[model samples]
Target chain A: MVIALCVTVALAIMPLVGVPKSWILYIFLFFIYLAMANMWNLLAGYSGLVSLCQPAFLGLAGYAMTIGTWLDIPWWAGMIGGSLIAGLFALLISSAVFRLSGVYFAIGTLVVPEALRMIFFLWRPVGGAMHGAGAGYMIKGIGDLSPHVVYWLSIFVGVGSLFLVKGILRSKLGLGLSAIRDNERAASSSGIDVFRLKLYVFIISAIITGFAGTIYYLYQGYIEPTATFNVRWTMTLLLATVIGGIRTVEGPVVGTVVVVFLYFLLARYAGYSLLIQGIILVGIMLISPQGIVGILRRSKFYDSIVKRMK
Target chain B: MIYGGDIITPILMGIMLGGLYALIALGLSLVFGVMRLINLAHGDFVVMGSYIGYALMRNFGIDPILGLIISIPVMFVLGFFIQKYLMGRAFAIASEIPLIIAFGISLIIQNAHQIIWTPLSRALNTPYSHMSFHIGERQFPVSYLLDFVAGILIMLFLRWFLKRTYLGMAITAASQDKRVAQLMGINTGRVYGYAFAIAMVSAAIAGVFLGMTFPFTPTSGISFLTIAFGTVVIGGLGSMLGTFIGGIILGVVQTIGGYLFGPASQMLLVYIIVLVILAIRPQGLFGK
Candidate 1:
């Protein structure tokens, strides 16, 4: 928690000394990275939904926020409303698609988001057609807020998301979720309501993702179907969670920092960037399923921390 | 508008186009059926095939059709190695990781293609490009008719191979149940690699045909991928016959959409069809 707070404070102060606007965008996206990784970890890592269609929820939040802005709601309110809208969509989808286990569920989830992207492309006014819809509201009072302020706000969201997730993990709901992940049949036999547990986690994951999406578009001042529903975003978040160490709290933050940093640095090169990212992922997954943080946790340095605490 | 020219021509053209789509999707379906790997780079192989065709023709004046004899085998070998080295391990991890890894490969290929070919579109540019028949009021491209026949023949041959050949049967068995097949003395990993290789061969051929039919560029495969995926899903998972029907439906849908809404909106409209179909039947039309 202290680490997260320090990271937030550092982000808040970075832009004052002549950092480029591109770096600020990168910083804003860094918080988004944290949120996305955690949300995915909650579902696939902890609860074992393993659904690959997290982008669909992101899309929902983006479109919902856009709709809210058009209706003259404040940006924050729009973001909250958008998050709720996305949660509803997740609930509706989880019931039908989550029936399949393992890869089938993952593939089903993937198809859902790709389909949603196409739907938005077809729906015109809903997705703002090809050019995409803007935030509809100009920033008025927030001009006094530096890039640091924007960065800190994003950090707060990321930290709050982590706590919310931590709380869920500590609750009875978390027990049910872990049980469902371990063995759905055994968990049901033990008197746990499996479907309800799955639904709760899936919805919670979407809600957090939606909140991130809403803030993302507000920061960018635009929303487009392709960008919002991008498969690349889903892949990035998944990589972060997996390579950071699935089913752990600190894993996502570590994973996101590495992956997001790589993305920002390499993204300018287009094709070369993809090659490097792909090789890195393939290498990581092959060598260590436990990921970087997982490996680190087992090391002597981390072991010493536990020894000291004891 | 009468005399068979206006309506028959477009419908005929659409059918041939649909045939091409089935050819490309065949590799996708086959790999998914047997290995359960999507080969996110399947489309990239198609892109590579086009470039190979373009290079052969541009540099050596080699016939585009003849160039396939070399490129197909080359791609097959490369794909075999990819499956053995890269994708083999990925199959053990959860499905999403492989997909993400494939996405990275796709990005690499996209850039590699950009660097090698430049980002500009290229075509086979053969003399037969202008060859077409005007039978009564209907116009037909000879190249397209040949493409259609080739697609059907390939599908029939694939069907025969899967049903008749010992290796093919082993592949099918492995796809159905790897552990059972392994228990039966089959090397599942070897079969998986071969299956993936064969799929890449199909994709390479489809790429040649795709370049012949339309201008080819690195980015062109992205939308084609959407359509191919839609057809695969609509036809049902791991079903070849279903892919054919799905491909045709996609073609007909796109043709009508283009007719009504113009080309600009055709992709969006086709994607909508895929979405609505999946919503209604999550298992897809031919899914078992």
Candidate 2:
């Protein structure tokens, strides 16, 4: 798609552009959200997991980054290791978590992040006096994790997520996940190994989301259990996916771009950012469950009335 | 640590606190039973009630108990309209839409409260707020006793209303099978409207107790939402009396958790209890 080419070109030339470093940072954050939404879409939109625990992986990756760096691991390696650990932990928990069906599964997943936050909050050995595993441990390891490194790494991860998700969607896993989503009992009867497929998607999604947090903390050079594990992260991605259009490839991308920019502008300019965001969210869901992409598809402009004539 | 008062006090207090939690969770169970919708804003509505009740106390010199009584009818009406208009419309569109709408509603309510009340922690700072009576030489807050009694009365009233009244049976029948109830010519919409209104009354009662017992802010709803949900799940879904007992059990566990591992660990312990209960009995202890 032309959109992908434009994004690739933008990523390539972004560093050379004579813009303020803060603008670059903002765009980098946008890319991070893009990836986060993709990851969530894979699980929720495709597999119907509907987990509210993405932050658990994010926090884990972040805490792992700090701890790994403290233990003499390189910053980049630590971040990767953190993602792998989050993936493994997700795999381990999926057995118990999978036993739950529907909303209970969602609530079960949520409890994981909350419990982890509490542990990280009270795990004084890492954080010292801080509420979560503090930033003090971070300072000892990656000295001045330059802003440029973070920005580029974020873009790289963002692109990586696109390919990663695309590959999965093209595989047997994707077909199986689609089947599971439509009807669990039917899929199970068809011998799709529904549980295993679901677990795989869950873990893969967790890994990607874990890396989103890693790059985030690596950039900020700080991590807190409460902030890192906030349910808002999950909610934001859910909103983005819904707005973009669930079960569509380009939906998250469009949704993320619109959301991140709107969020930036509103928080900066609007006096009542949350109130406005809430109003918009409710309006969007109520007026159109298909989301922005769905709306766009229905529009005469995007539908290309001229193409039909041709 | 060994003192008789130390353990006895928390257990009794927890039992009292459970009554309030039960009142809060009662509405959630009712709504879920009847319409199968979870109003994430249930906690916010409860907090809103607290704010209203607090205003009644501050401005009109009303007792929180009496304030609760007045708050209930107003809340019922408000809840009725919201269900009839906002949530009812959302449910008509899609199942998932209501949840998302509820989330947005919660966001709006929280921010609106912030804008209006200015989130500096507020509570019912009245003379009787801290007033207590002695129970076998152990101090017990009078408000806690009142809340306990109120919770029990609400539960009793709900039982009488559901089992004895035609409207109650209609609502129950709708909850069990809306399509069947509709086939029988019961007005399911009106039943849901009443269910939500009754749920609001429950939330208002909890709000009154929360105002009396603890400081709360605009952001206070989420924690209470979590607690109320936990109580519902622990107590078993669709059973009002079970929800009451679940609330009490949660309170005891929370207080005991605080007692053994300091205050910060209380929530962790409560979450553990919820998970364990779910794992052991997914149908809930009294679900069937």
Candidate 3:
């Protein structure tokens, strides 16, 4: 809640200092990524699923927002509605897929999104399949209410997602899911009901992802199957989680901020963006398995500060 | 909807196309089975193979068919060295490291290909390019026949090598368990190197066949890679026979789905099949 207040205050101050609208847009997009990376980290880093399909849920959410707007619904309600729909979809999928272990589950999750993209591409109601859905946006009273509003909304969502995850982790269901991660057989023997726990996490993760999609589409004012549900989004989210310290709350936010900043700075180059991300991901994993934040936490400086505070 | 022409031709094409799919997936299956690493760069390697074939044909006046022989060996050597130097260290970290590194490698190669070849799509042309034999009302390309025969021959040779050669046995044993292979006094690193090399060689051959059959852009490999992955999973990972059959199943799905639902729906058909299969038999059709 404090972090939310600080971010909201800071966002209000940014435009006063002559910051460009593009930078503000990038900042908003960064929060969308933060939301995505956090949700994925919670599901895979904590639950040990190693999923590469979170983007699919995001795509579904984005399309749902567009559809809802076209049908004359309130935009915020559409965002929540999209998230609910994605959550339901994830719940349905997890019941069957949670039975698989390791690679199979990873591969299985990937199939639905790819298939959904194809289905959407062919469906006529959502716009001419190949042409993609038109610019789907709801104009408020006066043209987007400035970039500051979008930035504040994004920050609220990002911090709120973290708080939600933190609350869940302290609850009984989170403990069961974590236990399922450590060893399914042992968790089952302990009467944790492994399948139910997995389904819950999957649904929760999907809802968060769906919100990310809605925000992305609203800000961008467009939806394309190729871009919204691209495999690269999955990879980017995974990279953020892995780089920022997978199983922690602050990890994904830090990682997403760092990577997105790097991507923006390096946008001019053709291949260097990918090259840098690849090197960072591979290098960090090999040298420090716990990720960049984990390294920071383990450092002597961080330890000394923590000891002093205690 | 299932007429003789619609049913028979699609199935036949699917089986024939499965041969090509098997070739594309062979490298991926071999590397994963042997090294326990999914080389995300596997698709890029195939893309490199297409370029190699193109280079050989354009420069030396070699037919695209003969280009495979030169390209395959070069890819093998490249793979061998890549494993010895880069991938060997990745094994020390978690399995995900290699995947990230390989994905980076994919990006690098894709960009390199774009720079070298430009964004243009190229098709291999030969005297036999348009030649086809008519069977009943359906026409089958001669190149497809050659592709099928070559795929089977390669699989047979691979199976024979695994069963008969010392190095092949070492590769298989290594894949089964590195500790066991090490305990048997095998140089586990060398087996990994050899296995990665052979997989690249197969990928090179697949690339040549794919290039000959269709026009290829640098980005063309992504769709094929996805399909190949779906095939490998359905055929059951590490099972050669399963990979072969899985390719056909995917091809059949694509062809029939294309016929019935339109071209766009083919991928959806395959994805749905994978979901159902994974839900029912997560181990895959023939996975160990």
Candidate 4:
């Protein structure tokens, strides 16, 4: 709670001093990524639904926002509207894809984006010949909000999502989710609505992911299929969530910060960054499969700090 | 504008492509059969194999066909070391951990290729690249015919080896029940290495065929990976015969979709068919 309060206060006040545009953009990007990582963790970590389809939902929301803005919808409403599109898509598709359990289910969902991207590439509605949602689509009245306002909007959405995931985990539904993840057959016999509950988590997770997509593109003021729907985005979030802590509540946030920090340092090197990040992922898995949180929890350094605190 | 003969073109071409696709998926099928571990880097290895071929042919001024001789053994050793050393550690961890590890391995390989090759697309530009024979108004590409023959030969060889060879039988036994096979005094670890090495052989061969068939770059792994999984899943995971069947099925789906729904829908249709198949039969057509 204190951490939350500090973050809220700091972000709330950071914009007043006329902070540089890039720093605001960095924090803004951080929030979106943090939210996404958390949502991915909720599905994969808690519910045992490891989906590469997160990018599909994210890209779907982005395009929906573009379409909404193209139709002159309010920016706020457009974000929500875009999220709804992603949620609905998930709702309709999950039943079919979820039939395949475990790794097959993961691969099944992975193909959806490739198929959809082809549709995006072939269909001329949004991106036209360029095979991406065009730059002409812009949110109405977005100009009135300063960059910091946009940044704070990201903060609100990001923190809200983490709380939402935390809220779910605290509730009975969360118990049901954990139950499903632990053992589906037992969960089913115990009278938990495993399919329905999974659907709910999936839709909710997609919505939050969709929201990130909307805010991300809205702030950037451009969208493209290659950029928006790229697998790199999924890899980034997956790496973050895995590195920070797969199942821990604070892991995704910690991971998002780590990734953003690394991005600032290594992104300029292009292919080298990818190679190093890949090495880091393998190294992390080899060294600590449970991730940074797991490492910290096990380390003597953390124990010493805790002993001193006590 | 839909000529009847044109239908045969996609069919013949897709069947040949399916032959090659079967080759691609078989490596994955072998690993999954023995270990139940999905090598997400399976496609990257194939691409890496292709890059090795590219380097050999470009730098040493060697023929594309002979390039496979060098690439195959090299890949075999690489796969052996990766399985014994890197992937060996993840086997003790959760099932998902290996998949993520493989993804990381894929990223490393792909970027490494990008760094070395500088993303300048390369293809085998031999005289036979476009050479084909016309048969009753339908032309068949000679290169594709050779690829199809190579695929069939490899499949036949795998079947023979499994039934006839001691090591192959050990691999089959190990795949069926590693613990039981272990009790029978079979060294499952070395068998896994052999199986992985064999899979690499297929991937290395497929890589050459792929370069000869199409223009390739460092990032071409994912597309091949998708097709490999698609074929494996469609053929029913763990079924060796099903890999070939699945490849043909996928090829037919792509070719027919292109002939009917425009060329862009070829890949889109492959995914759609797999999705529909999974929805209807999650265990796949022949998978138990």
Candidate 5:
């Protein structure tokens, strides 16, 4: 815990200490991805909901924030409001999607963003005439804010997500979630409110994902339907969580760092990045479905560390 | 009479369009019904077929329709190996593992297409690509007619193969109960491979038709997958007859919706219809 605090302090102070702007940007991206991956882990790794509708929340929140800014709302307030809208959207679709189980649920949710993409493309809620193929909107205001402020916001959400996951896992709600993940019928038979527990996790993840997305678009200073609602978002989250540890608290952190590194490393080769990531994902799943953390857990080093801690 | 033409023409076009949609849904329905595996990459496979046809046409001067003679066999072999090796192994580990693997395959195929073909839209151009038949005041594209015929023929062929062929019966038995089929001396693994291969054959055929019908990019796979999935769900999973009817329903809805609200809202309407159907009957129209 002391080590974690020191790391957070160091991260918080890096911008003030005259770090390179590129480094700050990289860290900012890492924090946002970590937050998103953490929430994804909470849902898929812990609660057993392999949702593919994450782009919907992310995109919706982005649009909300952009539109909110257009209406003279502050970016921070828009961020909160956008997240709430995402949560509400989740609630609205939950009844329909929750009915389907496993892969069907994943697919059912996958179409939500596609539907939203079409709607946004067609309906210019706050815009006049289609600008381009995407019909995107530029975020109003927020031009004067320093990168440090954005970086700080990302840190709060990123660290906040980590602590949030830790809190949930240690709480009664976490226990119920794991129980539900293991066996829904069994959990319900044993007096757990399976539906309610799943819904709670679902809404929570949606809201946080929305929050992270809002921060990302805020940093980018633009929001577009095609890019925002792109399936690549979910693909990134899946790749990160699955590659890291899944079900483990440190999984998203590890995964996000690797993914961000890969993102920069492969930034020059835009076409091949997704292909390489796909290959990595398939290779990892085939070789070690348990992921990096899972592999780590079985190592002698991990075992020795556990023994020493005990 | 002019007003009648607008309504009647769209409905006619929709019916033909639905026939093609049913063909696209066939492979997805078969895979899901028999193996209970939703190949998320199924649309990519269809798009791959289009690329294969495109290659045959560009390189060898073969017609896209004639190119299917090579593409069908190629896809069949690819499907067999993918199921026999990758998906089969993944299934042994867990049910959902294949789904993820399929997603991986989708990403690979989409990116590979972008890399190889460039991201520009392409379509198969036949000699009669622009030819249309006039029925009174309305003109129907020859491609649509050909698509409808090919779809019906394949459906008929599938029905016959499943009923008459020994391998087909084995597939049916295995789909019914893997363990029971194994006990009865059928190699369930091989049956699964064959079933998947056959499904790929259908996807290849559908891909060629789809390419002929519309211009497509590497990223067009997802939209195709959505259409196939919508067809399967609306028709009923694993039921041949239901797929036909369901494809028609979706086709009609899409066409009419497009007519009423323009092209952008077409997919949105399909999605709404799918969600509504799922909410009302998750088992689908013909699913047990």
Candidate 6:
């Protein structure tokens, strides 16, 4: 934990110490992705909710922030309001979606963002004319903000999400969640409020995901319905969470780094990136469903390190 | 402003559209009924079939309908291997594993289509592409009429096959209870393969019809998927007749919505109706 803190402090100070702008931008993306991936891990790995509607939260937040800026509302307030809206949306949909179980639940949640995308495409509340076939809005007064401020906010979110997952895991709610994940009926029968626990996790994940999304679009200075609510967001989260290690707190951290690296490496081949990632996802599920962290846990080196720590 | 013709026109159009939707959804319903697995790539498979028809038409000058002969067998072999090797193995690990694998397959297929086909929208131009027949004051496109006939014929054939054939009965039995069906000496694994293969055949047929009626691109699969999912949910899980009716209802609703709220809101209305149906009656109209 001390080492983690020291690293974060050092990272927080890097921009002030005259680090290259490109490095700062990369780190900013890393932090945003890390935050999103952590929340996804919390939902899918720990809570057993394989929600595919994460883009709904993220995009909604982006839209909210963009619209708010247009109306002269402050960016920070828009961020919080956007997150609350995401959480409220989750709360409203929970009753309907929670009725379905397992794969049904997955399918049910999958369509939310698609619906939101269409609604945004059709309803341009603040805009008068269409901008390139989508109801896109630009962040107002964004020229006055420095990149470093947004970068620090992303770092705060990234570090905050890591601690949130760690804290949740050690708490009673985490134990109840694991119980529900293992067996829903048994967990409910044993006095755990399955619906409530799942709802809590769902809403929390949505809020944090929204928070991270607002930060991202704020950095980008643009928000459009199609790109904001694309399924690619879910794809990235799934890839990062699955590759790093599901059900482990440290998994998303490691996974986010690899994903960010791959993002830059394959930036030139934009079309092939999703294709390669899909192949990797399938291959990993077939060969090692537990992912890289799972493979590491079974290795001799990990055993030796654990033995030494003990 | 409100005329009987206005109401009847959309309803008529919706029924024909519903017929096509049912055809696309049949494969999804069949696969899910037997294997209890939702193939996220089902729409992609439909798109693949369309692309196959397009290729056959482009290269050999064969009609899209005739090209189904090649596409069906090819898709059957593909689906069988995918289920037998990929999905079957994933099933043993976890229930959700197959879904994720299907998602992966969807991504691969969509990207592959974009890469190979260049993401440009293409339409299969049949000889009767612009041909339509008049019924009183209303005009019905020949392509839509053909799609409706094909959908009904396939649904009826599927019902009969399930009732009369040994393999079909085995699939039905396996869908009910895998353990009991296995105890009865039915090869559940092989049945799943057959079920998936049959579903693929249906997808191929639907894809050809879809190509005939609409222009499609690589990304069109996702909308088709949403339609199939909505149809299955509204119609219920295991009933073929229910699927047909559900498709009709969705078709009518979408048509009417588009008429009232412009074309952009057609899919949005379908989604809203799906959510409403899921909330009120999760089992669907015909589901037991």
TM-score of each: 0.87, 0.94, 0.91, 0.94, 0.95, 0.95
Local error of candidate 6 at residue A113 (angstroms) = 1.8
Rank candidates by lDDT, best first: 6, 5, 4, 2, 3, 1
Candidate 1 lDDT tens digits, B230-251: 7787787678778877877777
Classified by CAPRI criteria, candidate 2 counts as medium
Candidate order by DockQ, decreasing, is: 4, 5, 6, 2, 3, 1
Q: Residue-wise lDDT of candidate 5 within A129-235, one digit each (tens)?
A: 34446868888889897878888999999999999998999899999998888888899999999989889999999999999999998888888788878888988
Q: In model 4, which regions exceed 4 Å deviation?
A: A126-141, A300-310, B1-5
How much is B80 displaced in model 4, in angstroms? 0.7
Model 5 spans with C-alpha error above 4 angstroms: A127-132, A303-310, B1-5
Estimate the overall C-alpha local distance difference test score of candidate 4: 0.83
CAPRI band for model 6: medium
Candidates 2 and 5, the one with greater TM-score: 5
What is the C-alpha lDDT profile of model 2 across B35-133, one tens digit per residue? 877778889988998899888988899887788778888998998998888888899998878887888888888888888888799987767768899
- The digit string of per-residue lDDT tens for model 2 on A110-214 reads 788888888887775543334233323343466766677788888888888888888999999998988888888999999999888988988898899999889
**Mind giving the per-residue lDDT tens digits that candidate 3 earns over A20-137?**
9778777777878888888898888888777777877888887787777666676788889999989988877777778777777777877767877776665545432233343223
Tens-place lDDT digits, model 4, residues B140-248: 7777887788778887788788779999999999989989999999998889888889998889988888888878888899889999999988988777788888988
Candidate-wise lDDT, in order? 0.76, 0.81, 0.78, 0.83, 0.87, 0.88
Q: Clashes in model 3: which pairs?
A: none
For candidate 4, the per-residue lDDT at A252 reads 90
User: How many residue pairs clash in each candidate at the backbone level?
Assistant: 1, 0, 0, 1, 0, 0
Better of 1 and 5 by DockQ: 5
The parts of candidate 2 lying over 4 Å away from their true place are A127-139, A268-271, A303-310, B1-5
Candidate 1 C-alpha error for residue B15, in Å = 2.7
Top-lDDT structure, candidate number: 6
Tell me which residue pairs clash in candidate 2.
Answer: none
Candidate 3 residue lDDT tens string, B1-288: 232445778778777878888888878888888877777788878878888888888889898778877877788899998888778877776666676667666766776787688879987777786699877889888777766776787777787888799999998999888898899999999889999999889888888888877788987767777877888888887777788888888888888887777665767788888888888876669888
DockQ of 1: 0.44
lDDT of 5 by residue, B30-120 (tens): 8998899888899999999899999999999999988988998899999999999989999987776788888889989999999999999
- Global lDDT for candidate 1? 0.76
